[model samples]
Target: MEVHPANEFYLQTREIATGNVVGCAGALEVVPVSQVRLPPAPVLDVHAYLADVPYTTSKEARRAVTSSQNGIRGDAGVDISDHGLTLDDEFPDEFEEGLVQEIYRRLTRTSVSDIPGPEPESLVLGNLRQFFQCQAGEIDFKWQELYGDVVRFKGPFGEDRLLVSDPKALQHIYQTSRYDFAKQAERREVSRLISGRGVLWAHGHDHQRQRKIMNPAFGPRETKAFAPLFSDVASKLGGKWKDFISQSPNQESVIDMTKWIGPATLDAMGIAAFDYEFGTLDNSDNELGNVFANMCVEVFGSLSAKDILRQALAGYLPKAIFRYIGDNAPNHRLEQLRKASAVATKVAKELIDGKVEALEVGKGKSDVMSLLVQANVSEDESTRMSEEEMIAQMRTFLLAGYETTATSLCWALLEIARHQDVQTKLRHEIHRKEREIRERGDRGLSASDFDTMPYLTAVIKESLRFHPASPSTYRETMKEDVLPLLKPITTLSGKVITELPVPKGLKVVTSINGYNRHKDVFGSDSHVYDPERWLVPGRIEKTAYVGVYGNLLSFAGGVR
Candidate 1:
């Protein structure tokens, strides 16, 4: 038998040389059978040896070893050198074969299909432009066709290469906590236009510090204190809607609930978070409130010339000029943004300064803003926010409390309206809880009360999952490395097969809508609005697989 040199290591074993040899009295001593003639050895090749192995190749061998050590497999293979044979010669059992086949099937099933043949770069760019211009309703279908579930394109206005609609890949992306991924420059510009350099746009330590200071504002006690405020605002808005509907006889007046709720929630945020009022709930045209509302409408309405110019000179222009142009463009809408930011900031400053003065004067105040002021001033270390930082923190709280919650509520209502059964179920749950609280003589529902309403909470959760207002998030890879996507992908031209090689500086845009509706993870009815799915007794397995936004990508992932 010709021995391959590679197998020489396995062949030269003590057991094969001598069955038993006495060392001194009864002790066994290993002896080499040098005189024994061995068959001429065959040249050993690592590639050939690896090819003959049960795993197909050494790459698979390495993967198996890694997986086994990581507890991803049950057992290590048995040693065969003692039996004068190599482990690679042994065949796998039928069960093991079936298991391997099943795993491969599952993996192949989830693998991303090759992107169709590479068209002209201009074609891709044109498609993207058309996509951006498309109505919200038309976007989903068009996106699905262009890139079935995983698509990558370079940013139209920046250095970022964007990846769209790969949930498992998104999960891995969001797991990193280094704050390396951040809002794109365009998004930052937009946020600044709306909320200044607040927590929404802050990075690193500054963001953490701001979040700490702002925590108390959203604390259970603080949030519950604002429950009456929320009820008041909701009631007022409800009454206005009722009156408007009553006045419109015969023909129904089609109000954009989206437009109506923006101001109402703005009013709620002012009163609940800052102990002030936008007076939007009272139907009063408060200048600040009107300016803020108009700014939001205008900013979102159409891309301004300044926006176009900023996009054109993304990396070339100085940051200051970009911000200035964004804040003070030639358009009146831009002027409105500036005015809104100025007015809101001025009001926040006044509130903080007044609370500080009142506290110094021995007067007492216990609202969220007052508490924040107290906290901000009392720390020896790690407790201080600069006046500017305080302003940013307050602005963040205002935006977070107002915009996010209101958007969530709006989507929830819209979903509930469309699915009457779900609406009825949620209403029943809410009414039941309210009745319980009333019977127990609790004057108002607390944060804990909200927690206890499982069905209501589920409905909110489901709506958030379905219609996340910010449907996509952007990130830039900070380091150069091969990023193996959770799902493997074949290239459009069939030249390259990869999971996804996300090069450094590539911009990655995660699609919350796609991930939330992933069929593999969430099942066939993933697209449907079904709060009942979350109401099961135990934790939902599918939801646990989510990597962003507390296992959902509704909220922006990472620090920001």
Candidate 2:
């Protein structure tokens, strides 16, 4: 059942729906039941209410109050002494208090609420420049300038949307009350069209079931076993690059790493994810590679107005109309992507069938699909996934695992190229590791050897922090929630809020970019990409939420 935000007066009568938590409606004001048409509670010992409360040391509670006051209440537990933050000082200069007044007066008779954010210049057509900036790769600077830790604005559909950068609030959203917020429906729909009913687009129980079956294959042992495949694919790409450079008269070919990275990662994914070989590094016309490459060009390359219109409105169109247009329209790119999807679908089905047969014969391979099949067959009938579900999982992993890793590596290399000192230091570390390995009479560097190189690990973490593969992720609140603030914020009305009461159906954008560079959490140099900070003791501070691999939100936290 979906839960909605409601007033506190209804709390006694309102039952929280199964799998949902109702949001506190007017807790910001904490109005009494007597004022809301309910009989006042008998004035007995109010102290009894506190009797069963969990034990919290006064010092800890004081620290919490100091660090995180939303200003709605005075007793919000936060450690203010360490924060050195002020909400009034943080409000963007562009925000106009008069705009909120005008909005409440002219648009709706509802009471105006407090949150520090600039009223967009135009309500109906909100932030068109944001779309253009995202396309042009100039979004981070604009977002940083337009708002501080949190921003609220009218969305394109005239609904309220929020972009939050606060780490504490983010922890609640991503981990504490994760189920209360879900991936945006529209985004999930689009992903579903592209990748079937896979883990990427799955929600609730289906997602949990899929992840449970798939997680072990991606665990440390399997990942280490696949290391050689990665090295082989990377070496093949490097050898090709070397040959291309040597052929040039200047002995330095200007190659587009982006072009090479895709094929290399695809080949790696082929072996790692499915135990298949693409041989994409040696063959430009490799069927799956060509399909993917062509699809990328068709989607991202210059498009005619008609194609653009069709793509933009595809989400809103009926399923039949959308599929008809896709199948019959003059969209070469869409056709290629469709073909790639079809290919993936076919290959996944075949692989799963083969894995099932292999497992029956007690000769399963260590590839992800085989391990998953083995687990599925071993589990109880209730826990087993359908064959179609297995196929969907393969398609999801094939695309996501390779594409995201390749893009991140490309970004890391680009940063290394930009910073000569970092590159040199990294090279030295690699050489030192190689020497140590040779002295130990090892054939090559093992996963353990790689772990010994602190500098490389630092560089990768720094790169991920600076250039997260997914810059932003969207969520829609399924229930109203009270967001705890690490730093108290001053609302437009000048009231200090201790906790933010969010309305249901609210759209939120979690900025991975913004969180990675949060000032209070990471200190003044958060924006700077100095990997050596990781080497310094206590320089890399931990946050309320650490993501999947690192404290950074690059991989997001919880289920992701």
Candidate 3:
């Protein structure tokens, strides 16, 4: 049937159920079929849409629709329209109650039967765009009310699509490598923009290889070497805050902690991760550092931009263009990336040259760059990294090692400032650790001390959980298959959905925020700011569990 593109009914049939034909023959007759029973339409609890439903044009739409309706309404007793028929007449005094009871029964049954409902005919692109336009604060409230950590909603614009927000489902998705769920492509695009072709952006064996190369740098010895650096950075920051408070005699000055902490973190990562000087400790406005700082801010802020610009194009813009437009356009991201690439490449080249010079001069070095340089120089042709790859790795180090830690630190401090008691306890722990170290005649607190600081570790874990820097990760289906999970969901539109016979290239989102805050695993107080949750026996407890943060999917997970 030739359908009107602008008509809602027409679009619903075409977009939601591609093979279903919905047409008007001169307003008097609905042609071709004497009777038409569309799929039992999925209902959305929320006013907005964000989930997506799969669509296909090859299926016999009439049979699929009939099958879905039968699943929802039951086959033996109900007629087609009666599938979604309200109980208004059945129980006049409690009509709504009866209808709700019927729905709940259907949902429960469907959940067990593993039958997905029809694609939601209601959720459209316009509705979704409007949903996004709503204030983020209001959206948060809406999400809480609709899902409340356990509810399911129709995907933004898909047939029989639903988004389940239960902790058990989240845990199942996170833990079951067999299902092979992954993050959405939009998130990957963001990762590529920030981290380039490093472990964060790579997949499968490439990701594994990169992780192997980088894993040594975060080992016990290397991590211990960085404790002093962390202490130094934290101490300097505390001192700076003290000075700022002291200067505010009237308490009129309000510090933008995010601003200060961002740079401080850049500085810390430089020393701790690469043994390079960012000079943020001295509050020195180094040219390269400033550029780096600005670049980070720009990419994050681009979340609100309207234009969709390719990341490559944004990375290649001239520095002058970035300086002129600032963070206003997609081009700004490109320019920032370009500058970062240049700066990182230059540093890598310098490190390589320095390693060569050091070898000639007969000196040994222990820093990460030195190790990487030595490895690269000594490797045979097959294993050796190109200069470009070396630079990419260095850039990845700077991007991944610094920003996340800094963001986490910022959130931790913010939470502490808000929860003075937690702050006081943390400080006491820090002081006690320091005293113990001094009593042992240790010049500095050892890495063991950092590990032993229970409250401090708890504080860090809680902060990471509450305000994850990378709130989501993306992955794509490598093959079509059924995904088994703890909770089975029936789509709004009916279909037997399992590992969603997902086409090979379909994108999926691994929502860190949603997974971390799920109530089933975390308890009813999942939303509360409680560091005690991370502590067991007055020490930071490590256990085998599935989550988005601790043993969670905060970092990407896959076969490789």
Candidate 4:
């Protein structure tokens, strides 16, 4: 059952076959059951709903809001809060007021409804952008801005999906009712394409079992041990880049980070995760590296209409149907996926075989895959994963450890390249820290030393905040539930709702971009790439636990 934000907390009943966005209490809009025609799409009147609302507790964000000409709502030439943030004194300008009543007149006509979520005026076409942005674009935050925190948008064939960003709402989805929600059938089917029935693909009890068996491998001891291994791989990458730079004219080269970073992360993952050496950084023409890189290109790089349609329409079918489609499809993207999946499976099997052989001959291995193998050889059958499941886990880990990490490094480098000041500051910090450490008789930075450098840590956090590699995730409700809200929302009938009523079988989307750049959470400049916010004391106060790392949705929280 795919659960949407409107359903988990804000239970909604939509007429999906028709174009009707049926409202339920606390979900979209509390609409009374009636045959009513929707009027013309009114002009954007953000001021009406957001009037006199405090944007953030962060002093920096408040300052940004006050300094802006049009204030928080971005109404261009209109000054919303002239004397600065006092509720009773501040009001939307006359031009803004006319805009509000006009919208109110147009909206109030619709009777009471539930889940009074702000929806796109252009309907299905409008929601298409939300899908794109949620995957890997920048425009999805606009939906959150236009709608309240919990937004209802159409997916393939006008299927309702609630893009949830509200902190309290996300808490329920991620923590309070986590087990109550399951992976959408489409997501699971798609996961099988690349990762098979790995931890990433499994849901419910299967997910719990896999995660419990594998989580211990990534504990503090393994993580700390992996650090020096990562540094060595990074040094190999740097050494290769230095050679490239030396060969160029003027001792300078335009090294494409994309070409280099993917392999570097692959090498790092190889040694750290499986104790397998890919040697991709050392050899530019590494065959396995090229295969994975080509796989990525075919999957994410190409922008053909066929690819886009396939990605958008991915959720339209279940696993059995998707399997039929994959087997029978005549063309490119699916074939590319199949090829990559085969290669990944083959690689996983080899790694598993090596580990099994090593363990049999009394050689102990400590890598993640080895750990799983150890569990499989355990006397307890409950702790063991099936052979296919083990292969899937390896495939999942390889892709995650290679592609996502590589993409993140590229994004971080891009940000550094764009901002010379940040680059310079970071460079100075690295050199200064190295010199300081040498003076203390230390050779170089340790795993712990990385933490001592504030600017470097800040930059990494900010980068993750801005560009989460996997920007969106989905869930479906298993049972009827109600969602509590951190912020109350107003319905079409002028009533305010705090908690939402939810029913089972609704599709929901958790937007990493929307939450990371939430105005209330990170201040008005949340959209801006300002690492200084992390330095400031009161910039981001507190919220529900959002991430497993650096307070980011980039590393999602809760169980798998």
Among all candidates shown, the one with the greatest TM-score: 4
Model 4: per-residue lDDT, tens digit, 408-432? 8999999999999999999999999
**TM-score rank, highest first?**
4, 2, 1, 3
Give the per-residue lDDT of model 2 (tens digit) for 1-560. 11212222211212123222222222223333344342223332213322111111233333443254232112222222222322132333223233222222222111113465655545543543353235322454456555556666655534457777778888888888857888876666556655777788888888887777777778898889887778777777889988999999989868898889988988888888888787888798876666666354455455554443444445457767766665566666656656777887877787888777877888888777886677666667545777767777777766666667878988999999999999999999999988998999986767888789999999998999888887778788888677877777666656566567776777788878888887766668987888987788878777676577668899999764
Residues 1-560, candidate 1, lDDT per residue (tens digit)? 32222321111112211231111111212222232233432443323232121222133443653453332222235333432333332544543444344333222221112343122234224234433444542454345446555664433432224445555556556654356666666667766766766677776787787677667666656667777778778888988998888899774687778767878988877777677776775665666556555354465554544444445455356778777778656866567666666777887888898878888998746666776777677665566666776676676666545666777778888888899898788788888988998999987677678778888778877888788866677666666433445455555444344455443445566777777666655557877788887876443445334444436777756555
TM-score of 4: 0.77
Weakest 10 consecutive residues, lDDT, candidate 4? 2-11
Of 1 and 2, which scores higher on TM-score?
A: 2
* Candidate 3: stretches off by over 4 Å: 1-193, 242-253, 302-305, 308-330, 359-366, 378-383, 493-501, 536-544, 547-549, 556-560
The lDDT of each candidate is 0.58, 0.65, 0.52, 0.69
Model 3, position 69: C-alpha lDDT score: 42
C-alpha RMSD of candidate 3: 12.5
- By summed lDDT, which 10 consecutive residues of candidate 2 come out lowest? 49-58
Model 2 scores a TM of: 0.75
Q: Which stretches of candidate 1 lie over 4 Å from their true place?
A: 1-127, 137-149, 157-160, 239-256, 302-312, 362-368, 375-381, 399-401, 481-484, 492-499, 536-540, 543-550
